[model samples]
Target: MPKRDWITRLSTKFRQCQQSPFWHGAVALLLFYLPQTAGADLIAEGRAIVAEHCTRCHVVPEINPKGGIESTPSFKGMKHLADWRRRFEVFFTLPPHPALVTVVGISEERDKSRPAFVQEIKLSVDDLDRILAYVDTVKN
Candidate 1:
């Protein structure tokens, strides 16, 4: 608890850390850098997926100018909604969407009631996460 005791303890711990085979400095660097790197990767992958799949029906900024379908909303516009993330999470599981993409045992059942242009596209949960990550970067 004394000043001298605290200093001695700190120095001893530093020495132990330096002597160990484990590189604490490298671990610290990784801890600091990996998340941002992973996030950037996710955003990039998400952007690619959106460009490939959603651009057909939705307006994607920096990728597409006009919405593929007049009725469907633009990705840039959706980013402004308060519940965007939740809406996106379930967007593919809802009514008109049940006709699109089969996932996790969910089968694609094309809705004859909907337009013929609504095509089924398979997407995994990981894909959804990546898409959301990219969507998060969109400005309001």
Candidate 2:
């Protein structure tokens, strides 16, 4: 609540860390190493998500070997495009995607009767970021 209380809590934590030293290492590991894992975890999550959902119509060579409809471009090829980043960023709003993809909190739910579409993927903003982060690694 107050500045004094905050300092007191911090000092208490410092004392606790001093007493165990394990806390010091734990904090260091989290501060230094966890950040690297964050990007890796995001990419892993994106890979899994794409494998589960995107592989339906899109070819994601980073995660899948052989799949995707011929009409759709492979992520590998698309990565070299000038607007690839922008394309993935707002992909949920584009063309056939609108019928099959839904970005949580971003895109509205579509009617089930979207004609030829059978399934729609629901993705969060975080998922989109994850996908972008993974896509960023593509060789283009």
Candidate 3:
């Protein structure tokens, strides 16, 4: 469909729906429950992905406190930092993390001078989004 036509049709339907009792109830139920379910699912999947890839290096507090280097910061600890959101948003572009984590499409070339003793992690842009979403919910 043409972009303008599609948008017009959508707006027209939305306007029609706005006047319906069923619409209000449905929208209310969705507004009340959807975020809880969707956000929880995103966080849960992010946690699983982090457990599979990130726990190898970063701490996840109770989930994997002793899993990685003792000096490494936990997810909650990182979450508390002032630039935590920006840092996590572009973590794959940062030093050390880039060496360990590879974003499927954006990662650059790496040194192969020495044989890798540990496996390199692979993540998609979607996975990165999930990680940040999960990290956002982490508490001190």
Candidate 1 yields a Cα-based lDDT of 0.81
Instruction: Please name the candidate that would achieve the greatest TM-score relative to the true structure.
Output: 3
- Ranked candidates (TM-score, high to low): 3, 2, 1
User: What is the TM-score of candidate 1?
Assistant: 0.72
**Which one wins by lDDT: 1 or 2?**
2
lDDT scores in order: 0.81, 0.83, 0.82
lDDT of 1 by residue, 1-140 (tens): 56798899999999998877687778888999999999999999999988988888889878888557889888888988889999888887766666665555444554567633456677787888898999898776
Ranking by lDDT: 2, 3, 1
Q: Give the Cα error of residue 66 in candidate 3, in Å.
A: 3.6
> Can you write out model 2's per-residue Cα lDDT over 20-45, one digit (the tens) per residue?
97877888989998888998999888
Give TM-scores for every candidate, taking all chains together and pairing residue i with residue i: 0.72, 0.73, 0.73
- The per-prediction tally of clashing pairs is 0, 0, 0
Model 3's TM-score against the true structure: 0.73
